[model samples]
Target: MTTETTPKPQHPPLEPATEGQVLSGAEILVQSLMRAGVDVAFGYPGGAIMDTFHFLNRSPIEFILSRHEQGATHMADGYARVTGKAGVVIVTSGPGATNTITGIATANMDSVPLVVITGQVPTTMVGNDAFQEADVVGITRPISKHNYLINDVRDVARVVREAFHIATTGRPGPVVIDFPKDVQQAQTAFHWPESVDIRGYRPDRLEKKISPSHPMVQKAAKAIMRAKRPVLYVGGGAVIAGASEEVTALARRCQIPVTTTLTGLGAFPEDDPLSLQMLGMHGTEYANYAVDQCDTIIAVGARFDDRVTGKIAEFMPQCECVIHIDIDPSSISKNIQVDIPITGDAKACLAALLELVEPTERSEWAEQVLAWKKHHPLREEFGDDEIHPQRVISAIDEIAGPDKITVTDVGQHQMWACHFITHLRPRSWLSSGGLGTMGYGLPAAIGAKVAAPDRAVWCISGDGGIQMNMQEMTTAALNEIAVKVAVLNNQYLGMVRQWQQLFYGRNYSYTCLRRRSICEKVCRDPGSGKCQAYLPNIVAMAEACGWQAQRVERRAGIRDAIQWAEETPGPVLLEFSVHREDNVWPMIPAGQGVKKMMRGMELI
Candidate 1:
């Protein structure tokens, strides 16, 4: 019956009103954000939210105007993923609020903290279907960690404080604050609370109670000691909790071979000897094998996702003990049952476990993982005549180095980037892991660039995904935020086409991007020479948006193109014509186990 939330921010809340000072709700909201330490926000303006936007003009908080409402939310998501503080977004009601659904869902799924301020119709027009009014609270309730509707302008300061607190704490996710147009215009005696007090929620108890001597920590430590082959499965929670140091300490203390989920990439450095890299579907062969053969699994801040776990019955067939430590109490055993379930903040729990456990060696386990890694190394064994997708990604990874930020869209390219790129720090690798949204890369990259302008930011997206937020290039260009984008153009929707080719006997239906009405009826073959025409030139699109653009088709052009983009300033795009049918290797088919992993075309 216990529930725990994310750790509250260390930043102290603003002092309560020394004396009553009247202010509009719009100004109150902006002041609340400034006190919450929000330096930047992203949004598009509209009628319902225009008053707040006007107040924002005078506030010190930096705002980036996005082309689309959806893109604005996604940009906030991207900004939140990398930064310590919750990202802020402001948009008008109805379609503006609804447009943010996908991005909200994306943040919800991944546990990214974001405060989205949505405008609503006049209070008197509630349920009357006034212009640009929609039930935002009702629509977003399911996706957001929490949501609120300001009934009175007097509650603006309190609601904004609560929204940021709830969004950043206890399984961090987006929070929607629906402010009516009337409320924005109304006057209030602005007063910020000294502290947030939610009656039913008490994560402080969990934080204060969990120590090295806690029963669950002791139990997990015992479990770790007994197992001859232990594996540390790290995930995004570690990143959110800033527990990478703790995670690394525990892994090295036990010398347990570490494997990360896609979102868990940077928790343990891939270059480390104990690291098995990413596991599950589209994971490294060694990491999956390590999970399958290990006797113990100590999952840290990671849920047993279907993407990571495959078939529930068949996953971890040899594992004898399961130790799960997460900040969210509900997530502990939701997917897979665990013997030792420690629920608290990841940094706290991992630190406690680190103190309880002693150093140990598992040479046999290490050798087994090494053998698996060498047997099927992460690479592309394809002909050099064509520009393979892996080549473009790997070239970029090498050029970008280990410290730069790398964001990816979903599909084969996402999996390829996961396999090829090396992320040495938490929050360095960003992707829509849970939602698998296609258009996430570009806007998210802009957000990251805004958060960390000094660092190099790269968006490795598919041709299809880039187009979804391609218009954001104008936002990046006008702002002069330099974000390098590489489009892996495989002609067809690579992942879907790979599936159709694999399970459906090559009956490629509607996956092709270049399929014209004339080619749709007769063209069934993948990589058909007859269909030479490609639409919506990616380079031209980038150029039109005031970005430095290039097109690379040959193998040699991969490095040069990526290098050029890196060297160039402002926003840049590199479109690579990759092999159309090259599928991501080491893929675990849906509803299957690691035994059924497809490296080339067949299950291993």
Candidate 2:
């Protein structure tokens, strides 16, 4: 069959009318967003931002009115993570702006692209601490990739364009634009820049080709060829750069095993034999062992974060050579020294390495990794009686399918989801990876569903974490976003309690969400009859919000619960009554080395 596939035609970037009637700064701002191709934005309205909101009401851009600013930011983050586009957010001054800090930090940590616009007080009241005023640029300086406080109404179009450009470019992260109230009211001619030229802001520098003959690429290839055991450790950068195919090609071609960070989930298919689901704290035991044993480590788009490198000295002690590849030059050897540092896009560097490196059989190394995998497989069985959190996640994975997008809030459930769900596609797994923000799941799922309305979205949250932004349930219900929320109700702050149990001799200290003050510090088992009743019935709350809801306590009912949520007409909340005191295993205690991993009552 000799059939030619036509290439998809590319459309030119949308441009605003050059001689269009003069418009208010708010109108120009909306037009700027339209020009940048922003179809949806998550935000809240307040005095400073009222003008923009008024204009937004008439615009085609879909505005999602999140219950909280933090939730709105996460929604934008989730959208960006799934669509690879800069998610947009707009909020008013002071408290509204500060509320988004957590979300901004979360997005920054994960390298998710977001353009956050905050309405500011008038320029005259800049330092006067006017009503609802804030120094948003100052507050977000450290967290955002870049931030701006608009001084002139004419700068609106240019600033908006730059914000989007900065957000989506190399080493993507959130960019903040503070639009003053007076500027929004001021009149200006809207002239969207055809191209932005920011001096010293040359993200394009990272787009350069790394030829196969480049010395660094050649050196990386040689290092790979020389090592008998090489491990490909990837991170979120791989997902952001769309370098999954290149990463997999390099791993398979070189016969190297692959392990990814939590943010890097789905960068390489987890079902593959060479795939070591995740590495570092709460990572697979086999994966950690492989990293410890490998002679060569090729770190792609992964900065050696503290979570990933428990104790740097003890991490990869056997590794004699390191090849680091990332778009950000500073990220290379920032944490761990690298023998070969290639500063360029992940895909480009991997492609270059693929060309120079000759494929060789490393059967012995592969066998050793497989042996480790066999010896210490992930604990998936918790008997058939009670429902385990892992089983809940597994059931969801089965029902939702690999193609579905899964979002998670921070806690035991998040780790369990990472451990169990086999994410087959990049960006399908969304979580507050860097910041570990609680209450991010529901809103993020809303954003993900909004971004890809056709794809099924599942949100996995824990009892405590879900409560942080549970109010967003109304937002989801009102929008008719069919996001299936699985609350793993363990009746305790699982992660904190686990730490307390392991380190503080089970003091339990305030970790019990259900405990009353009169209860003992070391409370009785939640399953025991002595324990108090679980409060604020989650199922009842969901139903109150006009959502289809269910509560499941038995393992036999997991599938049916998940299926019900999937088939429900609108947003559904499934509360899985998980076992209390259950902990995420294969955990490296904080400040300890990866080698000192605790797995189900045994330290490896």
Candidate 3:
């Protein structure tokens, strides 16, 4: 027995080598990020984050110096969105972090995984109202899945690991990590954790809380199986869950016609035989009509936003039953009551539904939808205006082609882009869909380009909205991102003007923003809530930022400029001087149902 024990192999020395040195907190942070497989970051440099950015600059990761912190976060968001990885954003304290709040909230609302790292005031200055100090943790608490404020340098590695894990797992959303200025400067014997251990932060990667046999899922599955005319409505969640393949599979298997919400644009091929145009406020008439006619509505990872449902009580009146499949339980029956509710991750739920659904032909339903599409094809109301917003967008579509990521700012141009552009690929269209943020497009486009460097990115923005975050045009030039800026310069907040035209008898309060100051500077009253005196020559601004800039006043030139911009290697700006009175027609009146949809050149 003693012989069998055998001499234990000579143990190697566990002591540290005499020449070993402790790593700095900044080094530890970057090393941990490297361990997590992070290859890129987007941010603007600031005083608070000097040390961290210094270390990051010396590291292997590629850092994009954005024109604004918000743009940085959004670029990170777009990157995360396209790659199915967590987006990383590093910003300084106070206004820097605050600027990124919109991006964080956007990710949160869209359920996109993002990790925002911000530098705080020094540890010694805690609670002293120090310079550039903002309570980032408190500001982002409700918007983020969770947030952490680092107090010690040793916790940097653990916090980052936990932050990344929390961001990427489960119902993915943004997470914030605020590190004090002193923490980044401090040195420590940093040991990156092999794994993270967080209690009460479990993400359900397996089937646990919900099941296939569960009452809700069973009811939903049965309703879907029995429905004669069923329409599948999808949302951003499908894309976030990486369920695009499954969604396409399920739709094709059942031969069901598919339509999407604005956020759902890239989830399915708009050019598919079974695809209907996106539905809702700015959605196509055909899509709305299909919703009105469908006997049953199958909502997958979609919330019945007012924009989509119109008046909820009056929406889809012909539908006798509803089946809702969503990860968030609250969304199950919050608006239109659900006949069957299946609560699970969209990707998982769709996979299960695919397995349960017997492949059957919905040829009749598909034929009806096709008929609707033929009857209500999307068309430009404006006639032969080469510089018209719609025409410009159509040309951009032609030049950029599909599969390129397109972002839009909030205004008439946004709606026009949504209406005119045909999205035939998943995660190709990114916009401030829910928030409708004005300064969203330029920065978002810059971010999107950074995220998908291989894909051409276009920023479809209004003259008014593009200037909001137009400072980031420099970012595009600096990074050589080659993002094409197609400015739909209607010189007004287009959508609001449409509402005014329809609801207020064309009073046109404060929407007009044109100014030449030839006779007198016709600046809209700044405090009148109509417009402001901040309008600038965006072409000149773009040129100043090292981008090739051209203004398209002629209709024919719109397409030419678009083609040239898309083909050019570096950043280019194509401005379309559009008509102000133009409106996106086939207008569905407020408080009206889909049945009451206004179609094709109707005199209101």
Candidate 4:
């Protein structure tokens, strides 16, 4: 018997394609961004972008209000680094956009992908020096990977979409999109396109991007196989390329030891048995010794920066072959003569090398390296002084453990922090390596904490450097970010002072900055008992910023105070009053070779 036919329950098609309602130009821009998957933005609101900000709030997008425009940009940078996405930063015209230039330049140098939007003055006000007007597009042209000034409201949607694409593609640098205030307010039909078309922005079609299948990979693999004592030198690019695990595996497979640049700390866990820590200027004795003794040096994703190679001619003299792999072709053979140059993503290239190289035990070479390590262990000479920077750094490392992240400003204390702290994870230690910016520690720590709230973040700064960005403590307090700051109060720009003592016959020009009293006021000439450059009491400053504060006058109190601050669930500051005359040595003076290092203390 045939079953009775049942009526099917049918639903209407979701809907056939139809023309959507026309929207304001601002609405189109917002819709375009939503299509590009921008979930969050960081910026300071101002009048020029008022219209855009108003519409932006109506969308699902979230905005993190930053204390300053510069801080907003850096926060975006930190977010980008952590998420592997193009960070979005928006600001208003004139001073607002200009304040972000430093951060833009920094991202460019580091090859971070960022989408920076600035609000332009009304189209009619262009070139008329209108109120709050500045040529942001013209100013940022040299630094950004690409930029566009959108005068017409109709082009806002297209320009923003293309900006995101350009920023994230190719070498991955920052891109700027300037939207006129009038454009943000203007209404037009909103149609979010499924794809973007940009002539100069195709990254995948490029022929120069190195892949594992390149012909040079075989030559590089051959060198590694033939060499007896190979050392793996890595840098920040390795961290950015996510090649740490592969690098460690390659080192183990080839029985090679590893050392890293300052920015490369954590790329290879410093605590790893095969890791030699860092090399060059402030590098460990074992690390430097390994470089001095290795026969084959394989540099992966690291620029042979002068700071690492120290007078390139005499650097790694025993190394006969140097195999270099970098994403940027310009970095290859720029400093040291490279025997085999394989330009590519570090992770991909390293994986290919592992496939090509046959695992072999280099017993004799390992023995020799272990012998050198044993002979040249890192020394900590914490003499019977009132305060020792080394002891403080070591205590911090012990208290915070390997899971914590440390950010430092440039100075003698920076060198000490590098020498003492042991990094156990990739990108765990962030500092201004290339720029060597003095006030980086506090702001950078704030940025890192904002990016990774769960990780313990600490700012290692000199008294001089900390003071430079003391204003950032307010930023931390405002955000309720519990970043701890350890100030090495040496009462001088200690690095410059050390240089003068070693190279300039201790002329001691402007380096001597003396405190007036326990109040921490700067004294122009304490020799005469009169004070001029009074310093703000950092502990009190922290307290004013609604943070826990402590001043450790004695050396013994430093470690405990640091431990307390790290354990405290809020922003804390520990100021250790160290000797003003202490120096960071093993210094390679201007144009000096590794052999020409100035030791911390004169040999008997």
Candidate 5:
């Protein structure tokens, strides 16, 4: 059955307002958000932004008061990733605006659309370095797709509208509009422009559909038809362009196997036979081997980042041709050079290629990939005593199925979740890909659940990473958001420990979460008699935060814990005490080629 892709909802052209209808800048800002189809915003209130909050409280739009500015920004990012709408954020200047920098960088790196409105000090205090003032525009210019400082009250509506347009168009990313305190109080004639006409900014023109007769599309199609061992390498851009169906259709039509990056997890259903799960570091061994052996790589909407292309010169050494399709022209040939580059919307370019490409078979190559899958499958053999992290991820997939959204923090747990969880639909998997932000899981899950109330949202985080933004538990509790959080409590910074053990001769260093300043400098591994007691009980902390919490120490209780959390009405936290030394496998160590993957005890 073919699933029809829903086109992104466009804000209707603003209706002309009668001449000389005056409104405060804050009121105009609120009106502009409503016109942009934004029904909700995530932010924290502060003195500088109080004027906007006062009007927001009276408006129909819901304002979620996150526990921190960073959390608010992440929430907005999660909402945007799932809904294909520009997520909105409002925060005060100085620290409040600075606090959002990490989240802004995260969104910009992942190409998530967000419109952040920051409240600056009064225009009169611009150069005086006034209290609670910040140079937000200057600080965020490098990180954001675009940014503006509103000097005049009349520019509020126009700036707000253009912010959304820029955020959601082209290579989508964060946009900031710093509004001064005096401007928020100033009166402005609310003249909503019928259309935005930003000079030299024409993403709409670039998004035009390419016909199958286009020379580039024909070239890509011809290349694919001629290849014996072709691999379809996809990325987050495919998900953003809503080209999953096209990707799958092309893969099936050409008998090309599909391998995705970490950010491309849900772009193609992992359960499909031709799907190679994920490729790169921590990717399936078979997928990496397939890419290593493939003759041609049809890369769609994917930039070959370092994590994906470890030791770039040696990556895909056997590949003879590369056909890259992307909407952003700059991303093409930015990393690995391509033989055929088709620049346009991923969906459009893919559709055009599908029309021109002919169906074929590569039974020998498919068999080779399958043989590798059978030889080095993704599986962990844990003794009957311990709870493996992979089991927790698999159980969640089994209980929640593929329809629910899974958000993850960066670490071993993130890789485990990515490797084991079954993602059947686009937007079902959300993670901090490029920035690899540690504390992104819980807040992002909160935003995902808020944007999609009916869909179940699960947060998979590690013991080390979860604490980074665990304060958001209060936001979830206060808002009564039923986001299920599973903390893979390994009592160590598992990923770093893995690297330390393998490369640094087990000098664990600062990777142990239970280490204390007073403890002996040379601490042994857990159960080595020198280890101290686990610090700061996670379950107790969750209970203190007003969450329905539990601790699962054994493998047998994994399913029950997940079911209990799922059945709980409000926010729930499950601290699974997993084996401390377990490492994510099928990993190509940093700076190594994909062909040199180590799995299971091979690393040891």
Candidate 6:
């Protein structure tokens, strides 16, 4: 499905400011958001943005006051990732705007749609280092999909519309609009444009695209016909384009196996026999082996990143030709050279391929892939005395069932969730995949809950990553959002500590959370000394934030705790005391190849 028919309900436009009537620029800005069909916004107010915040007092659009500007933007990002509408964020100047850069870049890197509105000093004082003023447009230019500095009040509607258009169209990404204080204070007549028209941007063609009967698509078909081992490498674009049905249909018709990237987790059904699950760094053993052995690989809406494609030359050595389909023309073949590149929407390109592609017998290839999967299953040694994080993830997956969403923070736990949990639908697995931003899970899960209140939203975060935005616990509690948060507390920054143990020798250094001043300065292998006390007491902090908190020390109680959280009315925090030294497996070290993937301490 395209954005035109995407399932995310576009909020109906609220009553706009009366036509041909004069209003303050701040009021006009608020009216513009209403007219643009923005039912919700996430932000924090400050000196520079007081006017807009003041006008928001009477607007019908709902606003979420975040604890920080970065958290606000991340909320918007999560809102956008699941809902088809562009997420909206409003923040004050200087530090507020700078804080949004991380969230904006996170969305940009993942191609998630968001429109960030930041307050700026008066146009006359743009470069004078005015109080709370920063070059927001300049700082965000390289990271954002597009950015604008509104100098005049009259340009507000046009710019906001264009920002949404650029953000939600082909190859979606975050767009920033720097609103000046003076412009917000200026009076102007409000008018909402019926459509957006921007030169040099023609993403409309993607929607207008017909089922590709072109030579390029036909060539891709021929490649599929010729290959005995063909794999469908799906990505976030497949999710963004709502092309799961098309991708699934195409894969099934040809009986080809599917392998996805982290961001592309739910693009194809993981339970399907054809699925190789994830296929890169921290990917499954069979998936990596499949890619290494396949003769043809078809990438949909996926950029062949270094994370997905390890040391390009060694990525798909057995693959004869590459077929890549994406909406962004520049992304096609920009990273990995494409033999048959189709630059269009994933749904459209794929729908067309289904018409021409012929079904062939791949039972032998499929059987081989299944044999590899059976041989190298994703499993962890769980001691009866210690909690296994993988079992916790699997428990959540089983208890939550299929009608839920799973979000994760970046860590060993994130990879564990990917390995153990199963997601059968798009927008169900939300994570900071491209940017790998920590502290994203909590606020993002809150935003996702706000978007789909009926579904159970589970947020899994590391002890370290959760603290980065744990302040949002108040945002969730005050709003009474039923988002279940699971903090896998291992007492150390697990991923980094693993790296320190692996490549940097056994120097634990400052990675230990329970380290005392009396401990060794470098804290060599401090993880060995298991401490009963976890610093900062996440349960106490969460309960203080008006949430139901439970701490589970035994692996046997994981399900009961999660069930208790699900039954609880408001936000719940379940902190599981897990093994500190567990590391993510099947990792391909940076600048290495798939051939160098390590399953444990040694290369497979």
TM-score of each: 0.96, 0.95, 0.90, 0.88, 0.96, 0.96
Relative to the true structure, candidate 4 reaches a TM of 0.88
lDDT of 6 by residue, 201-320 (tens): 998776566465678889998899889999899999999999999999989999889999999999999999888999888899899999999999999999988888879888889899
**TM value for model 3:** 0.90
Cα lDDT tens digits for candidate 5, 1-604: 9988999965453343444678888878887788788888999988888888767876667889998999999999989988989989999999999999999999999999999999999999987999988899999999999999999998998899899989998889999999998999999788887789999788777667588988888888888999989999999999999999999999898888999988888899888889899888888888888888889999988999998889988999999999999888899999999889888889989998889888898899889888888888888666566899999999999998768999999999999998899878899899999999989889999999999999999999999888999899999999988899999998899999989878888888888888888876766554364677887788898899899999999888999999999888999999999888888887898989965678765655
Model 2: per-residue Cα lDDT over 1-604, one tens digit each? 8888897865443345454559999989988898899999999999999989877877778999999999999999999999999999999999999999999999998899999999999999999989988789999999999999999998999999999999999899999999889999999777878899999888777667587988999999999999999999999999999999999998898899999999999999998999988988999998899999989999998999988899988989999999999999989888899999998889888888889988889999999999999999999876558889998898899889978999999989999999999967898999988889998899999999999999999999998988999889999999988899999999888999888888987777788888887787766453465777888799999888888899998888999989988887899999999888788988998878865788876542
Pairs in steric clash, model 1 = 5-170, 6-169, 6-170
Query: Best-fitting candidate, measured by lDDT?
Result: 2
- The full ranking of all candidates by lDDT, starting with the best, is 2, 5, 6, 1, 3, 4
Worst 10 residues of 4 by lDDT: 10-19
For candidate 2, the TM-score is: 0.95
Q: After superposing candidate 5 on the true structure, give the runs of residues whose Cα lies further than 4 Å from its correct spot.
A: 1-20, 524-530
In model 1, the runs with Cα more than 4 Å from the true position are: 1-19, 602-604
CA RMSD, predictions in order: 7.9, 7.8, 8.7, 8.3, 7.6, 6.9
**C-alpha lDDT (0 to 100) for residue 518 of candidate 2:** 76
Superposition TM-score, candidate 6 onto the true structure:
0.96
lDDT of each: 0.88, 0.90, 0.79, 0.79, 0.89, 0.89
Candidate 6: count of backbone clashes, pairs at least 3 residues apart or interchain:
0
lDDT of 4 by residue, 1-604 (tens): 8888897965332221223557766667666777788877888889898877766766777667776787777767766765567888889988899988888887787777789999889988989999889998899999888898987777777788788877775466799988888888886665555578877555555424455566788888888889988899998878877889999899888888999987778888777678888888877767777888789999987888878888777889899998998777788889888988876777888888787888879998788778867876667765585877878889899988878888888888888888889887876787767667677677768767777889888888898988766776777787788999988887778998887777777666667666433423333333343434536788998899888999988976887898789778889999988876777755666666767766665830
lDDT of 5: 0.89
- Which regions in candidate 2 have their CA more than 4 angstroms from the true location? 1-20, 520-528, 602-604
**Model 4 per-residue lDDT at 75:** 66
Higher-lDDT candidate of 1 and 4? 1
